[model samples]
Target: MTTPNELRLLPWSGSGDKPCYLSTDDPDGYMSRLADSIEAIQLGTASELLEEASEALDSQGTSLDDMRCLVKELTGALRDVYRVAASRGHLLTTSDPREPTY
Candidate 1:
């Protein structure tokens, strides 16, 4: 029997880009470790992409194509990070709207 809290978190999402989780009784198994490894790689790549983007911003000679590629990579990394977080029941929270005073 597997419990929700003991389930393994997958590295990616399911249909419609929804988070997918594994209900494995063995959270310390190979697949779970693999997922963790992949997530680590994704985060690491995202960090590297951010550094490159920053460097690109400082360079006046960066080409449009190179910038576009960097944006695409960063976008993918963000999506992956989001999916992982969402899988772990983590969500983005926005502050409640405050009524404007006339």
Candidate 2:
């Protein structure tokens, strides 16, 4: 199974295809487009995992420890993705009026 953090581009490998270059040609716009793509996949996978966890928990009944742990793990996976993205500056922050923390 592929880990959430790994980048997979099938049919392409290093040194063959021209690499994706994030240049000063249009930094913010380039980063914004990258961020949008990241958000789409990250949010999509997170949503699916959360839904699966919810169904698993419901089927297993309340007070199930394993289900709770699974939910936490899934949540952590998502948090880590966002944290790394922000650290890499793919996400921008403003301090004026402040936005939703999440």
Candidate 3:
């Protein structure tokens, strides 16, 4: 069994909007692969949304409703990206050989 520190933070949430985790020794396991694939998709969507946001901002004709919709999508993408970053950061820290000085 893996320790709490070794648990992988899943990309999606659970009931009551709680964060989900996967505890596995195999990084190439089914769940791990699924999470990796989903993360990739999430990142790609965020990248495309960023480009769209830039274009929308550049266009003077972008309406308030359009901007609102874009903002909503950006917010969800940002949340996913943040979760991915945090999970990766934790993994790196736990796998590092050097101990923190502070």
Each prediction's TM-score versus the true structure: 0.72, 0.42, 0.92
Give candidate 1 regions above 4 Å deviation: 4-9, 13-19, 90-102
In candidate 2, residue 61 scores what lDDT? 64
Q: Write candidate 1's Cα lDDT for 1-102 as tens digits.
A: 455555555787689976667776565788778887888898898889989999999999999999998899999999888767765553122222364536
| Best by the TM-score measure | 3
5: Cα error in model 3, Å: 1.0
TM-score, cand. 3 vs. native: 0.92
State the weakest 10-residue window (summed lDDT) of model 2.
4-13
Looking at model 1, residue 63 earns an lDDT score of 100
User: 1-102 in candidate 3: lDDT tens per residue?
Assistant: 689888989999999989999999899999999999999999999999999999999999999999999999999999999999988888887866586655
lDDT on C-alpha atoms for all candidate structures: 0.75, 0.53, 0.93
Least well predicted 10-residue stretch by lDDT in candidate 1: 90-99
